[model samples]
Target: MTDWDQTDDVGLMLKKVRGIASDRQLMFFACGCCRLVESKLPAVRYLADRFEKDAERPMSRDEKWSILSAIGSALLGDIHPILRQFLMGQDNDSWTMAAQVASIGRMFEFNGAPESLEAAGPSIPRNSASQAQVLREVVRNPDRNIEFDPRWRTDAVRGIAAAIVESRAWDRLPILADALQDAGCEDDELLQHCRLADHLHRPGCWALEYVRETPERSSPNPGDPV
Candidate 1:
């Protein structure tokens, strides 16, 4: 981190971040680098522009969410417009974009996004239950060195739970919830367990109605309309 902070320019920073041994670590540090280099207003905009202008840019699922997750905490005012542009494409992957929006929407504490998976459906259909099981394994242990130590795995559930939630597959959430319960996740963590109906401002979500609404103590950060 100290080394990254001292080094200058996006080019140098990208080289450094891309060189990180772990993809997850690369994502974590890349986001941090963006923020440290002046809160990523330009960087995020650049990414959005590239994503918009270049229709053929081949980005992996991991790369897409890494960008989203890294910027999850960013103020919506700074990124919403470009985000809107990205998510608005009819030919684009709604599932991926929906998951990205869900990540930020949850962190920002709202769901006034421009679109919903319930309306447009998923770009890719997946087995939510099995995916949830895969996620549970990873959350228990994210290490690669433990072959017999019970943490041995080659995949990252990454944020597939968030994607499933954003997809609004209401019926499939219980499968994830069951997995979460089996994995011993409880309380707030459990609340965030792919059941974003509670967090979403969008209606037609069971999670929203299932959990009782309470009085508001404060508003989220301004400039975050989404």
Candidate 2:
């Protein structure tokens, strides 16, 4: 029932995948949503940093609670009200909290004005669409399993994937694709995703997940510099 392309509600899309996506994956989605507004809100950049790090090395529930509480105290006063609402509702289900973060992206754009949503109307839909794209690229599909050859994770593939994950250097994705090819990877979808120019590949990317051999529920460090 949820149209991935047309719907402007990123949260709805995330909701559809709540049962399927891992917590780290949801955090990655939240970080992607936060990055959409990070330039306008520097405080949000810190939030995104923490989320990305958490996505790679997921905290225990108590650790996440403590860290989010600290982050909330430090950031709640500085962000837009919508973002503040999201931070306040961290106890909600992962999809709900992540959807709240996406809502912040949909509603605000900093332009040295208090009430800028009206002026930011055009980008509201654009941000929502972009957030939806992030969700799609990260989750891919609910039932489809990407079969990657274990042999494809040669040293070169591991090195490239590690570097990209550490630096957030997505521009090197194509190079990673080349490494996979050299290692005899035949999965077109997996290889092409690394080569795709327009996609916003992030920390929990399925291709990188494959390289790290992370199960849907496992939270591995993946060499992310926290």
* lDDT (10s digit) by residue, model 1, range 1-226: 2433233232333333222222222232223223222332454545433332222244554565545443433424454655544454423232233334333333222223334344323322222322222222112112212112112111222133444434634545555555544544454433453454432222112222222121111122233222
TM-score each candidate.
0.22, 0.72
Counted clashes in each candidate structure = 2, 0
Strongest candidate by TM-score? 2
For each candidate, the alpha-carbon lDDT, in order, equals: 0.33, 0.65
Q: What residue pairs are clashing in model 2?
A: none
Compose the digit string of candidate 2's lDDT tens values, residues 66-135: 5444444333446456445546754654545555556555554423323443443454443356777778
TM-score of candidate 1 to 2 decimals: 0.22
